[model samples]
Target: MSTDAERLGWAEQAAEALTEAGYRRGGVRSAIVALLDEQSCALSAVEIGEALAERGRRASRASVYRVMEELERIGLLARVEVGQGIVRYEPLREGPGHHHHLVCERCGRLEPFTDDGVERAIQRLSERLPLEVSEHEIVIRGACRSCAD
Candidate 1:
């Protein structure tokens, strides 16, 4: 979980980005961005709507999806497909410091991890290949410790 201050900072940054992109900072969008900022893992659109409702922030499913898509368009969110047709969204970090996911196939648990060696290897591969790699996502699927136990 992120500290309250950290989450607030993220929300502020997202609002600034939205404003700069010529979008108004409406109530629903603000709530959705705040929710995404506080989350440590990706969430589906339905999940996001439910969460907002739980907090007394009512928003229609369509509105939620639209706002999510806008956030993704502005690079504030990343859409992750962990398989089984389940699409999830998570906040994108500021720059190249973004992490990848380790998903537990059995329990559907998602964990974020970062490794300098993996980043270096990707850079080396990019250099060796003719294609210029702008970004990458690694999703390692296996049983988690609890599921294995």
Candidate 2:
């Protein structure tokens, strides 16, 4: 879990980036970014709106989706598909360092994981291939412990 200070720092950095990109920082946009920054897993637009409502913040579903799209445009968010045609959004970390997801197909659970071996393999593959791989995401789908039982 991220400390409140860390979450605030992320939100501040996002605000600065948005302002630098000639975008006005509004309540809905800020809230959406803050929520994404504090999250460890991706969330759908519907989930985002529900979370905001739980926190006493209100935004139309369309507005939330639009803000998410804008955030993605600014390189602050990435769209990840766990499975089952569900599109989710997560915060994009800086530079080439990022993690992958382990998704439970039976229960729609997403878990973030990092592995040095996988990273090295990806780097090697990128070197051997014609394309330069700056970033990558690998989603492994299976059943969770509970679901498998």
Best by lDDT: 1
Error of model 2, residue 70, in angstroms: 1.2
- List residue ranges in candidate 1 displaced over 4 A: 1-9, 94-97, 105-107, 123-134, 143-149
Residue pairs with backbone overlap in model 1: none
Query: How does candidate 2 score on lDDT?
Result: 0.82
Model 1 TM-score, all chains together: 0.77
Per-residue lDDT over 1-149 for candidate 1, one digit per residue giving the tens place of the 0 to 100 score: 45677667777889999999999987899899888887877899989999999999999999998999899998888787766777789887634336888888887777888888998898889999888866778899999999999
* lDDT tens digits by residue: candidate 2, 1-149: 55666666667878998999888987899889878877877899999999999999999999998898888888777787867787799877643235788889887888888888998898889899887766677888899999999
Global lDDT of model 1: 0.84
Q: Which 10 consecutive positions of candidate 2 have the poorest summed lDDT?
A: 91-100
TM-score of each: 0.77, 0.81
Please list all clashing residue pairs in model 2, or write none if there are none.
none
Clashes of 2: 0
